[model samples]
Target: MATLSSFLLATSLVLAGCAGGGGGNASGTAGGGGTAGKPHVLKVANYFATDHPQNVALREKFKPMVEEKSGGSLQVQIYDNSKLGAEKEFYDGVRNGTIEMGIPGLIMQADVPKMAVGEWPFLFKDFAHAKKVLEGPIGKEMTDEMESKHGVHALAWSANGFRMFSSNRPIASVNDFQGMRIRMPNIPNYIKLGQLLGANITPMPISEVFTALEQKVVDGQDNPIATLKASGWYEVQTDVLESKHMFSPNLYIINGKLWSQLTPEQQRILEEAAKAAADYEWELLEKSYEDDKKFLQEKGIRFTTPDESFRQAMETAAGPLYDEIYQTYPWAKEMVEKIKAEAK
Candidate 1:
């Protein structure tokens, strides 16, 4: 008889308990670090730039609300731009209880391979379709498995937006993907997609991408367009392929062990704040796409929208990969069907 709200709250009771290292230079904080009546400090780690919506939401929504609503019993300290570490490192930090919380992407699939569903290329129809599936039963099903098997818990699903390709050259057709040297995060979904599209996939971490692009080590890279703007990758990149090839969602996660230690009231406050912050990020990012495209245009970054034929070709290229997924995860076919059904 539990409603969705109750389920989310229960799942998010999977939040912080580990006190992070000192917070003297954290991106945002509502309390002094002097330790008077010492509130519980929740250390949040993410790799997004300080100005990115992820950090903005955390600073604007999550930090303040958790601090205020908990009546200062809980304090949030945000470490933006890998201040704690990169995606995998911070993720491991959360898993081992060295850190309290994080917003990592498909890197989580390393531990929980099924989590790959989030970044599967060309799977999502659009933002609304994604929201329905990931926040509904399907998403809960995945996150529930994630929490039980992995050590981190999902607080809420936030937007990373749809990914676009930016490069030194234009991606005008499915043929352009052939032999293109594209940088991809070292996850199987990305690697397989790139290979199938005939891209010469170059795997690397996000931190090294700028240098790689500037040095011509790779032809291009993929990320949300807003990320292209926020990370300032546009300075060296000349064109964007509005592929929207994949939609990646960032889950605000807390240490599973730490989550269990919190009192019910504290858990409720954190859950509300986390979801509110995630929603705020989604709002900011949805608006940022067009705004960011305009900004990129102003900077002389050209844009390309794949026409119907090209899109179909790209989807066809992805067909074999989906077969592999279905073969690997017995339930992926059913889950994917459920996802497609939502679009109708």
Candidate 2:
């Protein structure tokens, strides 16, 4: 039997080959320009399943648009299901130009901690407000900082939906979260949030979450409803609380070196395609969330809707972290204020 580590390694190598090997040429001409025969192959990596809305948009919409606009000058190869690597690995691959593009998750906060401000517990009014703040000046500033400091260019940001808590045990109120062992991504802000919520934070990669849950290593985990369903986490989790505590947006990033290598026309095509794909995915988010919720209910996962008093208690508990975040990341205060001002 193949171990998980070995399976991941083999998958990475196979996908790497597919990304690097330009199997065919539209024409024989060879040059930087997208002339007759020389086509620029852009490899895009994502951790989502092939059926996920984001992947569907990339493969069906983004790829076709970029290819058509480039007039056979560009070919896009997408590696879904973490074929390239995990979220952090994907970011590293893009930064080093091993991968041309990736939609790395909030792990991007490691590069630009100011992004943590956008994810404050119960920050935005809803998804539309979150979208507005991100697509506005605040998002641009974050993108600029990333490109300037991290050597990765942000193409566009798309919705990852609001994160909710799922547990093996019922969590009907804020008091129920006290001392609960909760699995969280290994990111500073997330750790802090879990701490503020009175959870015994257990940081682990997303891939290990299921096993952790089944073995009862952690009492609960949090993710968007769609993610819980898509990842089959509902099978392990019995109760879900609609905390809607954080709104996460996935950023599509390209290597700075790779971006610089592209012709101005090529860059425009890629950027436009990314934007279009982002919009398409955002359109699907609400429906996907609703469908996933229905699916979970049908599968017998108990759901909890927090009362106003419970929500207030959660907010009160997490509010102090705002000052802590500002102290840790100097720019975070300003970004948080900007996003709050923009949020409806």
Task: Tell me model 1's lDDT, rounded to 2 decimals.
Answer: 0.86
State model 2's lDDT: 0.83
The TM-score measured for candidate 2 stands at: 0.87
Q: Residues 1-344, candidate 2: write the lDDT tens digits.
A: 46988999999999888766654332333433543233678889987777778898898789999889888888899998788888888888988888988997767677676666567788888878888988888778767678777789988998778899999989988788899999988887788888988899999877788899999999999888878887888889899999999887898888998788777778888889999999999888767887888899999998899999998998888887887877777777777777778754
Q: lDDT of each prediction vs. the true structure?
A: 0.86, 0.83
Q: Compose the digit string of candidate 1's lDDT tens values, residues 71-168.
A: 77788899988889888899889988999989888687766766788788788898888888888988887787677778788899998999988999
Clash totals in order: 0, 1
Query: Which residue pairs clash in candidate 1?
Result: none
- Alpha carbon RMSD to native, model 1: 13.6
Task: Please provide TM-scores, in order, for all candidate models, with all chains considered together.
Answer: 0.88, 0.87
Highest TM-score: which candidate?
1
Score residue 186 of candidate 2 by CA lDDT. 88
Tell me the spans in candidate 2 whose CA falls farther than 4 Å from its real position.
1-38
